[model samples]
Target: MTEPLIELKGVSKSFGRHKVLDNVDLTIYRGEALGIIGPSGTGKSTILRVIAGLLSPDEGEIYVQGVRRDGLIEDGGQEVGIGMVFQQAALFDSLTVEENVGFLLYQNSNLPRSRIQDLVKEKLDMVGLPEVGHLYPAELSGGMRKRVSFARAIMSNPDDPTVGPEVLLYDEPTAGLDPIASTVIEDLIRYLQCLHGVCSTYAVVTHQDSTMRRTADRLIFLYEGRVQWQGTVSETYNTENPLIKQFLSGSVQGPIQVAG
Candidate 1:
């Protein structure tokens, strides 16, 4: 059996008095795409943060590639090799698309500007946004921004091979897009994963049904800060689990009650 690329053991997190994640254990294996799905405020995004080293758990241990890490990762530590794409795209509005995609390399590595430009063009092309590198973020549509965000998240500094990410975490990659655009982004996500061999594992937190169905090989249902259930994507549609049923049906009346 293949060892998990990333593992969270008995993880728990809280903001002030509000507990967001509780004893959540997850394992992400190599060469697999996993989806974390649930209602809002279920800490799906928080899970990605913890994995990315952006947020540390108050309780539990995080192991990446079987090594434990401490605190926020300092400069030049690349063992974890994690990348994240925020829900809002989070592009630097002032920079051109090429600059945005190549920001890390230009700022942190010794790579010549010409080489970085070539890599940026390759990534943009991989995401099906070829020749848009000269455009600014504001000039592009929401879906384009999302694709650019993916390109940026996966971009690595060739000078420092360790800087390349081994695990990609996405927080709501398909939000705020029309159905057609959402499908485009979904397809792009799969395409980029295959193209970027550096990233061996991926986890996505999303509420889009089509995106989940199309992108995820395995599905985890998070509810009330816990991993309520997990299974293959096909099992998600056939489960008799109440929470899964309610979520699939989007019914207001069920075991899960909405906040008044």
Candidate 2:
């Protein structure tokens, strides 16, 4: 078997006195698209942050491709390779799309200006935003901004020999979009994975039914700080587990106790 591309061993986290995660363990295999489905405030996004080193788990070890990594990752003191798309596009207000996508290369690569420009254009084209490279974040639609974020995250190709991010983490990629638009983003996510030969794409998706059904190959249902149950998307439809059943059914009267 190909070793897991990413693994979280007995991971736990807390905010003040509120424990958000508790001894949660996970493993992701290479070249797979895995989606997390759960109700609100369940630490789904926090899992992504933990994987990205944006937030460290108070307990447990994190490994990438079967090797342990130190805090923030440095070998000979350089940044490691990972791509991310945030729920909010999180683009720099002053930078044009091309500038944002190519920002890392300009600072790191010794390649000439023309070559960098060509690379930037190619990246933009890959994300279906060839014309928007010259535009700023404010000028584009929300969907466009998300695409820009995707492009920039994968732009540097930080790892050698391979040409892009090893892992792609997305935080609620389909939020606040119409059905058609959400599907477009979902398709784009899959396309990017296949096109770049990404090792694995881990997504922290919200409680959007269509997005989950359309995108996820495997579904892990997080409830009250733990992964209560897990299975494929189709299994989610027939689950007898009350939380899973109550959630997917959109029912208020079930085993799930909603606080008053």
Candidate 3:
């Protein structure tokens, strides 16, 4: 089997009086595409945050490349770099697309301005937005903004190739877009995976069925802060599991309770 890139052992997280994750254990292997899916408020996004080291689990351990992480990512000394693409494509409205994509390099790296611009142009082209660098986030369409976020997530400093993300966490990359636009994002996800230096391993937390099917090789179904079912995409369609059936069918008559 491939080496495990990230692992959550007996992880649990809570917000105020509510428990968002309950003794959940999960693993993400190198070079794999994983999907986390479930009803709203089921802690899918929370898991992604925990895995990315953005949120330290209330109780449990996170292992990156077989080494236990001592604190949040900001504490430093992590062997692997993990990047997250938020659901809303959280770009700064004030920054131009070029500035947004290369924000980290511009602020942190000593690279010359011309070099950073060249790198930004390369990433924008990778995401099919070579000319939108001068445009602001407000001017781009929803899908275009999402793509720009992708460019940012994959951006790396040329000085330190290892600084690039080895794994990516995506929160609803296809949400709120038209079907055709969603397809475009899905295709781009697969396309980026095929690139030589781009991230091949990623975890996607999404409620969109089409995105789930096209982007993940393996799926884990979460409910009530726990993983209830796990299987491949084909098994997702063929299994007799009631939770999967109800979710895929969007029916109100099943083990899953309607939110309302």
* TM-score of each model, paired residue for residue: 0.96, 0.91, 0.99
Q: Between candidates 1 and 2, name the one with more favorable lDDT.
A: 1
lDDT for each residue of candidate 3 in 1-260, tens digit (9 for 90 to 100):
59998999999999999999999999999999999999999999999989988898999999999999988988989978898999999999999999999998988899999999999999999999989999999999999999999999999997987678989899999999999999999999889888998898999998998999899999999999999999999999999999999999999999999977
For model 2, residues 8-105, the per-residue Cα lDDT tens digits are: 89889999998898889887777667788777888888888887778879988988867775575423232335667889978999998988888878
lDDT ranking from best to worst? 3, 1, 2
lDDT of 3 at 71: 88
Q: Which of the two candidates, 1 or 3, achieves a greater TM-score against the reference?
A: 3
State the displacement of the C-alpha of residue 162, model 1, in Å, after optimal TM-score superposition: 0.2
Q: How close is candidate 2 to the true structure, as a TM-score?
A: 0.91
Least accurate 10 contiguous residues by lDDT in model 2: 72-81
Q: What is the lDDT of residue 17 in candidate 1?
A: 97
Off by over 4 Å in 3: none
User: Residues 1-260, candidate 1, lDDT per residue (tens digit)?
Assistant: 36788889999999999999999999999889999999999899988998888888999998877877678655335476788999999999999999999999988898889999999998888888998999999999999999999999889876676887878898999999999999998887787678646566789998999999999999999998999999999999999999999998999989987878
Candidate with top TM-score is 3
Distance (Å) between predicted and true CA of 173, model 3? 0.4
Which whole-number lDDT from 0 to 100 does residue 257 have in model 2? 69
